[model samples]
Target: MNAFRTLATIVGGSLKNNATIECDDHGAEFFKVEINSSMDKAINHPDLTFLQGLSCRDSSSSTFGPLTLAQLSHFECGEVALSFCMLHKVGDACSAYYFLRDWARLTRDPKSTLSPPYFAMDSLMPSPFDGPMVSPVVEPKMEGCIHQRFIFSESKINALKVLVVAESCWLSGRIEKLPHLFPNSITMMVLSFSGLTEDPMPILEMLPNLRNLDLFRAYEGKEIISDNNFSQLEFLHLTELEKLKRWLLGTNVMPLIKGLGIHNCPNLKEIPQRMKDVELLKRNYNKW
Candidate 1:
């Protein structure tokens, strides 16, 4: 409990200060922790059913400010499971992963040096637009949603890969009405493809609502440049681009971007000077 409380202080942002999210405003902040005892041993359940009793559920309509819920479950075999639920409005999956990673590091060695977490709510919500916001898809009600879990074993994954390899073909030509086809897509991830030689920003910036993008070994280029676009983009992550040496951005590009993460780009020596104005920028390099 003490460890988690300290984690909250480190990564909870406004919630650490007891701020809440309101209907028309933002203010009451609370972080809830619950502990439970289970008679069943974790070894008996190889499936995800074991998590059913170790997690907490939250509602979107709740007035809780920056909701961060944690559950600790103790089993008969003396094993413990810790679960955390963070509101999507407060942080995304990447944010959660780093938060948990830092927490584990802290628990292992309390005196170890840690990278600080960045919070940019003020930068994210600079000003409210005066008209009704337009959305490409209708929002679904949480009450009508059903939750289910699917597990894919190594054998199953290997079989699927074989089938995909047998049936796959290369595609060419420009795709029309791309935004109309994927209007609701807010996040995109690309990995392990080395054929892309041109800068991908021109095509990707065409995405009307894309907010988060992650690229890992997806391009085989020496340089990347971006124009003055990506008006709605908020976060960009670049990783393992071994050939990339330079990245340049035009003026007023990615106007709303709040965070940029770079990792394992050995040849990329410097980040854009303009990126210094962003609220959060994290870079990890293997070598200069």
Candidate 2:
């Protein structure tokens, strides 16, 4: 119990804090911690339903805290289960992954160094109001929900891949002639070319209806420029762009983009200024 408490303290920031949102006021909500000790060796089983009881649940109140921690220890089987339930308003799945990773690292070695958490979302996307905030009402209902589990073994996955490859060959033929045949009809594109020395924007911009673009090691250039293209693009993902240093977007490019993701772009220095306030931006880099 002491070790878990120390672990929680090490993950200090918002996980340790409680927040409450009301109609016209914001206050501290309950940060509940529950510890359970059981002698039932069934907790050592791989059943999913048994794991659900290890976490805390508050069905009585519609509003709850941003974080909840539950620790379950089985004395007979000598197993410990630590569960965390964090609200999406506090952070997303990636945030939870990093939190758990850092906690594990600290658990192994308390002196290990970690990258500091970034908490400047308000500065990046500021709210206009300075007065009391109004919380949206959340009504919980489970009327017609059905849950089922599906398992795909390795052989099944390989069979599906065979089917996909047959379709992909036909799709590849269509994509090769896409610019001349169906530029306006194609709405999504994924390009990955080896040793591509020229800019791909000029060729891709012709597809006026393209809404999703994913470029993975497609261009081996220092810079990429887009000039008034991708008018209907809603999401863009760039991955493994090793040499991309600067990306420039025109005033009218990607006007409808809602999500932008950059991964393994070690040399990307900056993004377009117009995309600073996109609804979702997932960026991962070794340097910047």
Candidate 3:
């Protein structure tokens, strides 16, 4: 209780009730739970679900106010699991990461100095819409929800690529309208992890699922983008690869990239004439 009291003081700041929860009629409240259990048993429990098992908070019971909850479960094998539930009204993914990181840091070293969470965003955004907001804190019972997992081995991936490549027609789309939300996005870290040196064309030819690609520090000698590649990509970013001396873009390659960012590539020589037909050749033309 003493330790928790201190923790609540640290995390909750000056606000008494859960900070960001606002129900239609009610105001704000706090919820917390803690338990110690065998990690192996919990992991293998058939009926125990991920969300409820992790949270263990009675969110279904109306708190009569805004709600903030935390759950901590300690396993016998020295593994500790912690969960925090807060509304999107509170923060986004980056904020969640920082909160978890600092919380863990403080739990390890109670006296650790911490930087204040940035509330500067609060000032820029307009005042919250003046109306009753439906709180989705309590998850509704999901009916007919089937959860399944599949492992895609190297062989399976290659088979899928071969199947996609068999199509004789190449189709492309233009961006007449853009969506406000991007649910599927990929980053350049995927490229850096591949450890490919000669060219990045083969991977592009194989994978067609991505719509956004951010490739950073790719040390490939030449980036050869053929037409009919990256047909669905809308956003592209390349950065910090000196070895990238030439770029060949085919007319059918990347026909729909509306946002493009290139940085720190002193050796990059050329771009596609139409920015769609990308082709590469070595030249001392000092391509920017």
Candidate 4:
């Protein structure tokens, strides 16, 4: 165990409530650090207590993404302090769990003898899925389409949260939309962790059984649905997405997407023929 790290392991069933990290883009990686000034006085704070009770694995990656350093620090103050770190999902899950556990053990008792966990990335990769890879066929469209982007305002976000909590608590709507609320920000988490009532708007229909999503670019800044299966998506949204190349990896998802649209995607260079072929609708692209 390394005394240099943060927090002690709260073993047994208690761990079930602790945040055990996971990522949708198992390929993506980030770490969180929380500092408690007094060795024995930080972990008992309400946020850490809530964090102790909440399951990190059960929470959405989007919500987990925006944990600020201050929040992390505040949660670890006043007894039972913690320094939390979440690694990417690209490698073994057990390795991450025990690594943190060992760190906690060391932090809790510096004299406790424990072998440190090793991280070797190369050894973790396995032979490919042992399946045939699909080929991509794309007929690019003209680049005259308008690209738009937008972000929900605080009021809009709060309103969404209220609607979601009401619906989740009421046991309404399909089970799928629940995951949409969990993003890096606390606000996103509030909205995502709750239920979404049915909306008369077409957007509700677009969210059916959808597992993964991205807000990279929209044609008119309107939310677009990409008709891809959530089950097989390896990557959801790529940063700085101006255009899509050949839809290669998750082609199997085409039929399962409940809703698919692209608007206000300013940099989206080429449009796929299949997407444009569908009955298309256009809406305003709100600015971020």
Best by TM-score: 2
The digit string of per-residue lDDT tens for model 2 on 1-288 reads 333344444232232112322322121122333334443534465342133543332433454432434333343345554445545545566766776677678778877777766655655455558522345334456778788999999999999766643311112111222233433566777765444566767777777778877776667778888986788889887888799999988898888899988878899978899887886656444422
For model 1 the local lDDT of residue 116 reads 61
Compose the digit string of candidate 1's lDDT tens values, residues 1-288.
555555566334432212333232122132333234343633465332233443222343333333555545555446656555666756677877877787778878887677766755444444346322333223347787899999999999999766544422222333221122333343443334444666776777766566777666667789988875787888887887889999888888888898988878899998899887666556544421
lDDT of 3 by residue, 1-288 (tens): 333344344333322232333223222223343335566676677222133533323433334223334556555567767666544445566765776687788888888877766755655454457522233233545578788999899999999766544422221232222222322222221243233465655455434555556555544555645545676766665666666767776656766667666677787866555654333222222522
TM-score-superior candidate, 1 or 3: 1
Scanning candidate 3 in windows of ten residues, the lowest lDDT window is 169-178
Runs of candidate 1 exceeding 4 Å displacement = 1-186, 191-194, 279-288
> Candidate 3 — which residues are off by over 4 angstroms?
1-37, 40-66, 123-288
Q: How well does candidate 3 match the true structure in TM-score terms?
A: 0.32
Better of 1 and 4 by lDDT: 1
Which regions of candidate 4 are displaced past 4 Å?
Answer: 1-208, 211-228, 231-249, 271-276, 285-288
Clashes found in each candidate (C-alpha, N, C closer than 3 A): 5, 0, 17, 42
The digit string of per-residue lDDT tens for model 4 on 1-288 reads 224322222121111112332222221222344554554443354453224433333223323332211112332444443333332332245654675567566656777787634445323443246322233223234478687899889999999877754422122223433333422221110112122232111332234343334333221222234444344212132222234332332344445333344444455555555444544433323522
* Candidate scoring better on TM-score of 2 and 3: 2
TM-score of 4: 0.24
Q: Between which residue pairs do clashes occur in model 2?
A: none
